[model samples]
Target: MKHARPLPAYMVTRYHGWKATTHAENKGWYRRLADEGQRPRAMIISCCDSRVHVTSIFGADQGEFFIHRNIANLVPPFQPDGSQHGTSAAVEYAVTALKVSHLVVLGHSSCGGVAGCYDMCSGNAPELEETGSFVGRWMDILRPGYDMLPEGDDEARTRALEKVSVTVSLNNLMTFPFVQKAVEEGTLSLHGLWNDIGEGTLEGYDPDVDAFVAI
Candidate 1:
């Protein structure tokens, strides 16, 4: 194997800082966790946006939540064609192997992926519609959500679709047989969440009201 370049100075300094502080403070807790295998109770599907800090928002410690971040936090319908599917694979592992009690589909406001889908479908982003675009194909998972959004100002439409994307993923998660079985048997619960990054507020999808309510 080829030798890789060294890490940046700032990254190395950050590691040393963490080792001296957080890691030092949590050494015993970390050691216990390493001795015992992780048994996380929840699986969080969230966007890959750097602004969305999953652990920070939940105040979660290590081994508390199994998180999978992808573009738009989108999950496609269950497809068992013996092909590569990263999101589905994670869902399968979390449901079947991890036996997580909760599966949360987390979306956030001002999502670039959601906005790209809106633009692609609304004839504003021609480049995204190209056949070879990976992001375009990925954003297709949220197309159904975009179609269901009510017409409004650009900002309103974007925010609405962002929340819709969470619903779409939650709906699609049921298409997976294992997920459906777990949910039916009361072994797993599904949740839809939308975060306002700027406001630092969270809204949860209420099935009865058919809207996101502050939690």
Candidate 2:
């Protein structure tokens, strides 16, 4: 099947608008970034959801953050066994190359990935369990998180698992020897966050309280 050769007109129009406004206005900043290269302070792993606007929500400018988005913002255990791990590659570059001070895993409410995991764990989604299913395999990372939560209604379970996704990712990050060393040496800090898409609110995971506290 042939794919659309060119981008849609609306997308081109939006790009032009952005160029005239955000890009042109910050021409010098963009130029400087080009010349000096990027040295972002934080590496944010967030969902692929279009609703989660990383830069806008943080009021960040160009070159401010190193952001990576995947289905559920997950970081699998560091497996350097000649396997292609996109998330792990980003984490390695951010930590070893960029030497970023913060590594954040941002989960969000109404996460379809979390819901899928819920359905998957509950045996409601057979396709996910299939060997040919990529989403099912990916969401398996969140299985331990789901298993940790107290049983509840579907809505409650999904909501709780969304937060659990963050903590689980945080735990997974530590499995990397470099990440653990950085945290121990005080060069890096790990954070877990849950975004309420509609409410425009954020909650941070508190290890002490073992709950998500409004931030």
| lDDT winner | 1
Clashing pairs in 1: none
User: What lDDT tens digits, residue by residue, belong to model 1 across residues 89-202?
Assistant: 999999999999999999998999999999998999999999999999999988878779897898899999999999999999999999999999999999999999999999
List residue ranges in candidate 2 displaced over 4 A. 1-4
Across 1-215, the per-residue lDDT of candidate 2 in tens digits comes to 48658888999999999999989999999999999999999999999999999999999987889999999888898788997899999999999999999999999989999899999999899999999999999998999998898877889988999999999899999999999999999999999999999999999999999999999
Quote model 2's TM-score: 0.97
Candidate 1 root-mean-square deviation in Å: 1.1
For each candidate in turn, give its C-alpha RMSD to the true structure in angstroms: 1.1, 1.3
Structure candidate 2, residue pairs in collision: none
Worst 10 residues of 2 by lDDT: 1-10
